[model samples]
Target chain A: MTGPARVPPAAPAASTAPAASTASTAADVDGDVGLHHLRLYVAGQTPKSLAAIANLKKVCEEHLAGRYDIEVIDLMENPKLAAGDQILAIPTLVRRLPAPLKRIIGDLSNTERVLVGLDIRAKAAAP
Target chain B: MPIKPAPFRPSLPKTPTGVAGFDEITMGGLPTGRPSLVCGATGSGKTLFAATFLVNGAVKYGEPGVFMSFEERAEDLAANVASLGYDLEALVAEGRLGIDHVHIARNEIEETGEYDLEGLFVRLGFAVDQIGAKRVVLDTLESLFSSLSDEAVLRAELRRLFSWIKARGLTAIITGEQGEGRFTRHGLEEYVSDCVVLLDNRVQDQVTTRRLRVVKYRGSAHGTNEYPFLINDHGISVLPVTGASLSYSVSDEVMSSGVGGIDAMLGKGGFFRGSSVLLSGLAGTGKTTFAATFADAACTRGERCLFFVFEESAEQICRNARSVGLDLQRHVESGLLRFEAARPSLYGLEMHLARIHRDLDAFRPAVVVVDPISAFRGPDLEVYAALLRMVDLLKSRRITGLFTSLRGDGGLQDAEDQGLSSLMDSWIKLQTVEANGEMNRTLYIIKSRGMSHSNQVREYVMSGTGIGLIEPYIGPGGVLTGSARITQVAREEAMQLHRRQKAERRQQALERRRAALERQIAEMRASLETEEEEAAGWLREEELRELVLKQDREVLASRRSAAE
Candidate 1:
């Protein structure tokens, strides 16, 4: 939780590049690194919510491949859950894993901003 | 069905906000079922106003409300307004109120592409439905602008929200931060066009006063002037004196002016009930004493009195009044008299007016006394305006108002300079006239609107038994008072005594002369009798001589003389 325990063996040296599809299967292993845990908050399955979910999945598949876990929470079904994440806008994406949490609002249409928002590219370039 | 003409309606329907004096200024409160924008600078009581609106609706009007605060949490808001006696938590627990705190941090989130405020809508809708709320407050919705960089989307969403609120027929209040030139930071006044109220906290001469004004009310007639308001333990109360109509019913009743002598000068034995009386005097001229006497008289009659002392504490006033034989403490203890004492510099004049208005509403006293109203140091017009409002407030309730003012310079002209005499129904000026090296108090009824008051100035004297007015002494020197009057009175009495003594002495001499003359007349009569006897004797002797010749002639004469 403090830091990435260890870089996943399947992950490429340059994590900025897309990891192999098999890398995501190793996310359950202990001490696996470069695994992204994201949670998307949505009120209902509106167009914006659907688009955010699709775009978030596409960004995850393209960037980290199988190295991320996306949990979609529908606030309409569970309105009480929205307070826990301090969600004010629909289609909010919260990065819960890798220590310091982060949030990005709106449909994840811009891949570059999403990558930067999740610190994937920064973590790779700096490491 | 036959076609029917629509009934003529003068104004838009209103939802009463239940805020004191506010509804009167708005004519009936805000336009019903529409969003009203309440904008003000920070710490200007915007939150309190909104909360009062919501809480009053729930507790008083049986209307449930939803309060969505973007700045303060539910508990904080509740705690903040608890001083106003609004049990927000109790209301919430009773299902009459719903408080949702929307926490937004600018640094907590990043905007990826496009988003709307549907999540906020969901929360607000849930709260409203949960309470069946007829009122809603979105306090500071403008915070979203700072949290999110997308102003275009936020503005569009706000417009939608307003329409949505209208669609549901919910009376909503949307508070915003005041802008440099506009009414609100984001110009929320533009979206909420039904009504807009602006609150202002102005500091003048290091004193702050809160004022409220209805900037615009579409299709409704509302007061446009800035009405001074107050935020105390009871919450925000607007003093809308201008809105108070002058048509309040008048009473033909007259009440005593406390002291019997002053009442005698009023010609009617008292002042007109529900009328305002001004007691003005120089320093130490017993102005407060007169006011306290009036209060004591009112309380003695089993009527309640409210005394607002700006110069002294209630205890001090009661104690001083006691020295003059006015037992005000007894009245206080009997709950017939109430004292509200505060420093004139404690707040602005408007705040004082609001506070008085609040107290009047609570106490509903039959008489109100503002001792030494001149203690309020401010622009003459401001003080005058405040006093005018106070007079109107008291008159409208048919409460007698006795206001005392300290006359500067102790001149007749100085008393009239305040421009307050015109507002009072009766003006009593107390002057300290220095005569014969002594200062004496004199009372003059400058004016009594409906009564033929005495025009003569009476010497005012305060002894252990309270105030009394002595008949002015118009001697050769003219209008003498104090020891000068006493001396003049004594001198006139001495002159009268001397005149009476001289007349008595003259009568005694004339009686003595009459007695002497009578005695002399008696003596003369006696002498004449003696002479007559001698003559008779001589006649007798001659007769005797004759009798020597004709013996009895003298004897006959003697006999005749003896018979005489």
Candidate 2:
């Protein structure tokens, strides 16, 4: 890739092989200009991973809905991909498009900690 | 060898690294289609070892390799390895080797997103495809740990990298710097790799020694001992110096000792062709001279001789040998003899042995002579065992060995005490005896296995032409020696003269007594004759008197008697 960060044999004229975070790649670049991209890492589709996904969706809808992108990654299919995000715990959520990378642990049950971690502004509370 | 090459392959095949002395320890070489970890402290020569392995693979085994360095650039590594005699530029130009220096500028990037090392894998795969590389080397795995902030990410990537390299069926070496508690800084790659080799640089008593040990080798038998390794222009050479067993075919052919006296002292008038000989002596004895004689004799027989002089220079030994009539210079000039002269303190014992082994391999000499190898005694070496390693190498090659050992006391028992006498096939001892206020050289054979050797201690004499043994001294005081022998001879002469004079005087006395007795007999015979004449005269006078006065009685009686 043209990006000097990539160590490739055939130099690409465009950025390639950059950190392929699932949320960053899936985020709608044109529409979500100011949108925050998020990634949730879990071992498998267990109760914890499913509960984490459901609670994160609920928080996104109640707070900054339609402005954020969330991508869930299962480590069982691709265990090696977890290392790129520094994931040591299962059911960990990472803010992929923020200025400073932030990590939250657990099943996202604590709404207050989750809001503080994701820097979410609640639409109902603000109106 | 793992299972005798059965129909079904039970394990991975070994690909020889071709580094000097390393393949022997690995049985054949590193496991093919597997990733091996090499970890050491800074300046422990890990990169050099890895580079040598790669270069040797390309040059010797015809297996092209890829070197992906994370720390130094391509030019710096190539230059460093080039100084060690590796033609990196040539190999790269020929497309047999690929050097990719991945510059990880830690300050240039901020981690705004997550990513896997798919880019690195792609580049490595391209390089592998470029040269059909069968081997790969990642010289600084620790740099990857520093470049990334997340341990989980780096560890996962490393595991993935090892598995990928294995999947590609290429042998790989990942080198890392040792950390305080972990085998490597990241501490997880060693678990992922199939084998782990640890390099250690230790300074004991101010002498630095590099040692290597294979911590783990999955499904392969390897030497687990801490082998002393030497790094130089020839790369890393590991000497398993103290291994209890080394199997080699032994030669029983006897070889001359060069000097007639020494040969006669040895069993079968010589030593086994490949056996090791130990010559131990005090200072001023004939150890060096005897060793020179052996070298000269070997050279004269048209066999190559490698003389490693730890005490003197080759020229000095040659010049000294001229006094003893050994023409070493001629053999040296004729190319039948080679000399590697250096002080024992010039290098650590490992380097010393490595140099000797390297030279021996290059020269392929039939006879190897180490003059006073005991000089290698220092803080960093177990000199006895180190000497045995040298001997073992020579024996394995079927090369004759002659080693000289210096003893503080002039006794062969010192050699035995040092345990060299037991290892050597023959042990000869030289002595400096202070006989008659002069130091004299005498030699004796302490032991010679499998043949009857001379037990008599022959006094070794150095002449202008050569060295030889003289008949032992004998005197009236038992074997006469030194000044006492001369004095005993003079006393014997004087006593012999006195005895001769006494015998002459007794003969003269007997002659005088015989002459006197003959004179006496002659005088008695003359007296008897004179008495007879007087008797006749008396008789005549008596007759006349008898005729006159006694005529009456004597004459009358004589006449009567006459008448009667």
Candidate 3:
């Protein structure tokens, strides 16, 4: 069951932005190309939860530009949503778009880990 | 003989070996319907761990188990785990478990022909059927190997036995004493089994560390590391060593070292909390003094402490403390400290463990001091296993454990004692150095778990008041002995006092000299002033020099005549 397409489509850099611009031009075309419709599942203001959010914001702004929309979902406030995602491990991140939806577990710091897990670099190669 | 009825074989369920940590290591219990192999060296807790598993299953878990022993009888097994808090009687009475002691006498039971495990299997099957048993334990399968000389028959029967356990869908734990380089003597039984657990009972430097390592688990991701397991009143407690690194956070809190100068030398001014320190030295190197000082500090901080005296009685301990100027009696009387004195040979390794477990449970002390764990060493490896369990137990409670090991003839660098050494979080070697013909006791903290302890051996002296750790002996031929340390410290103290006296004398002489110099300067200035006035008068009289000169001469001659 697919959810609503609240996340915006990838930035239309396919026609304009060159392949060489993947690293440098990623900052210029900063509109939901890299991690959009991202959902952060957490449970209250635990150190892990706070760290997860802080790490995500730092990572997103630095890498994903202002175009990415991060949905902070508190399981304590909405425990029912836990059933939909098979969330055994807490502080899980669900990358909705960039199809074949990847789920990255744990408080996603360790910059290189987040970069590789989110599959953002593959977006620039789309025809 | 014609009227003799067939022998009665009652229904029985397979028995479970209720070893405490063993079950946990197996995960959801040993293959619920298969015979698994438990192999270890002599006194590696192979039989004890296995029997405890069965007894625990029956007595605690309410799952009836049958234990068929080829070695020790029912009473022996019961008595062993009795210290471990497993009451085998209640379980037997409640019709839950059955203990069948099958003594296969080598001389008595003759193997006249090709023997089969069918007779033993029949006996076990009968026991299982009678109790509706869910678990079974066959201890030391080596006994069968010893009984039956043919390896081929033993292998066939063991394989058949494994199949019978599986076919019957009963969980079974079979134990065998480990052979050199082999998991079990009768290989196919343990080989075809679902799990293999290896137990090691090793002793080094008189401290025994019993470790359980899961060599293989077919379908589960068990803790593959050598987990330290303790067999006490409640049975085996496995200290999971796998995920230890993930749990630590660095902190900068300087805890007092219970002694003055020692703390001052430490940049942070103290040891860290949850740090294990070892004070190892020769018999007279004052290792106990260090432990007492630590206990004093812990007790003073309102944190409860446990002192396990191995070599001395509690009263003797108090007396020893008095000699060293540490009054532990007050703390003990005040209930802030608990002093436990027991000979290392007072009980089996497990009994010692049970006492420690019970004491820690009752007192809930923050610090535990095992004064001279080296006393637990024996010709056997059981002591080492017990020591390891004790260490693991302390670590789990996060108790700052201080263990004093008495290093005898061999110095602290003996690799032969690495069993206990590896388990230690921190190691301190105390050496009595003979420095400049005087006995000096120096303490060198060889290792500290999570903090950097002093490497240099500092001189220490205990007087009427308390332990006085002084500056490290600098002018030393090498490390000083105990007698030399005392003499060296006295000489150094005397030298310091002499230096102070000399300094005082120097200061007094300098003060007197300064006062005299000031007086001289004042007088010289006054004389110059008088001379200047006279010169001014002379300059004024220069015009009338002849007249002034004649008057001056007349005045001078009058003054001279008056004086005459």
Candidate 3, residue B50: the lDDT equals 76
Model 1 agreement with the true structure over B1-564: per-residue lDDT tens digits: 111212334468788888888887887787888999999999989899999999989988889999999999999999999988899999999999999999878776878887888878878877888889999999989998899898899889999999999999999999999999999988898899999999999999989999999999999777899999999898888877876768899998999998998888887889999999999888889999999999999999999999999889999999999889989999999999999999999899998898999999999999999987888888877877888888898999999999998877766566444478888999998898887799999988999998898889889889889998887898777899999999889998999999999999998999999999999999999999999999999999988787696656667788899999
The best candidate by lDDT is 1
Instruction: DockQ for every model, please.
Output: 0.51, 0.03, 0.00
Chain B alone vs. reference chain B, TM-score for every model = 0.91, 0.83, 0.58
Global fold similarity of model 1 (TM-score): 0.87
Instruction: Please rank every candidate by TM-score, starting with the best.
Output: 1, 2, 3
| Residues B461-546, model 2: lDDT tens digits | 77886887876665544454445555776888899999999999999999999999999999999999999999999999978875
Q: Candidate 1, residue B182: CA error in Å?
A: 0.8
TM-score of each: 0.87, 0.71, 0.50
In the range A1-127, model 1's lDDT, one tens digit per residue, is: 3433444323222232233332344443533445676779898878999999999988887776766777888878867666656778888897765444678898989877888888876766775
lDDT score, candidate 3, position B234? 63
lDDT of 3 by residue, B80-194 (tens): 7788777777778888878777654433222222234444565677778779998888876567667556578677767777888889887777887777678876564354557
Candidate 1, residue B157: Cα displacement in angstroms equals 1.0
Q: Pick the candidate with the highest DockQ.
A: 1
Instruction: Output the better candidate (2/3) by TM-score.
Output: 2
Off by over 4 Å in 2: A1-127, B1-10, B243-247, B379-381, B411-418, B475-478, B482-564
Which of candidates 2 and 3 reaches a greater lDDT?
2
